[model samples]
Target: MDEHQGTAMKKKSSHASAITMNKDLEHWVSSEEQADISKVIQERLKDKKPKGKCDICRVHPAKSICIKCGNSVCSSCYFTMVGLCQNCLSKDTIEKWKNKKTDWKKILEVDWVD
Candidate 1:
């Protein structure tokens, strides 16, 4: 009857509705239907192949692809450490060194100014 009691009843109803909705969803699909859907998905995935030419050699068929950049690369150009094609991984390394060089230059400039 009071505002507090009304709010509590609304909260209880919402919670009960959520549980009922979840229960309804649990039986929405039969086990056979689920199995069929999963089988179809697996078959489709199995047919999928990595796309693009080798990023490094640019000639060989790419056997592996980088998960991050999705760059197709041959086994020879694939770097396992970073899970990237050699070209991408080397660019990352070079960028890091460039940043470090700029940082060192800035530090030296500050020291000289002082």
Candidate 2:
């Protein structure tokens, strides 16, 4: 077969693109309505508090905060030695320092900038 026959060129049409806005999902919001929504959301966020439940177990009341990620956790889900939540540290690392204490405050002191 000839090269031109093997590799055919696809001609782009002048028609509109396939992407189109769905009218059913679109909504027209006025400036006044938008401002009211923004104000209400801000007020609700200001009054909202932590759920007070363990992020890991979601059953027990959170008694401590993980120093690494600031996630609220119960005694069972928190690694007190490393000052990190079960979600932050690996299982192997948790077992390695099961009995040892870590200076997690040093993490806060470290300069992150390159």
Cα deviation of 44 in candidate 2 (Å)? 22
For 1-114, candidate 1 gives per-residue lDDT tens digits of 999999999999999999999999888688999799768655655554556678768888888766556667887778666566666666768567446644554766655432
* Superposed Cα deviation of residue 37, candidate 2 (Å): 39
Question: Against the true structure, whose lDDT is highest?
Answer: 1
Where does candidate 2 stray beyond 4 Å? 1-51, 96-114
Query: Each candidate: what lDDT?
Result: 0.72, 0.69
Q: lDDT by residue for model 2 over 1-114, one digit each (tens)? A: 776754543122212222234443366778999799768655654544335889899999987776656677898898776666888998887787676676656768865554
Clashing pairs in 1: none
For residue 57, model 2's alpha carbon misses the true position, in angstroms, by 0.8
Candidate 2 has which clashing residue pairs, if any? Answer: none
Best by TM-score: 2
Every model: Cα RMSD to truth: 14.5, 13.4
Candidate 2 lDDT for residue 52? 83
Q: What is the alpha-carbon lDDT for the whole of candidate 2? A: 0.69
In Å, residue 59's CA in model 2 sits off its true spot by 1.0
Cα-based TM-score, every candidate? 0.33, 0.39
Worst 10 residues of 2 by lDDT: 10-19
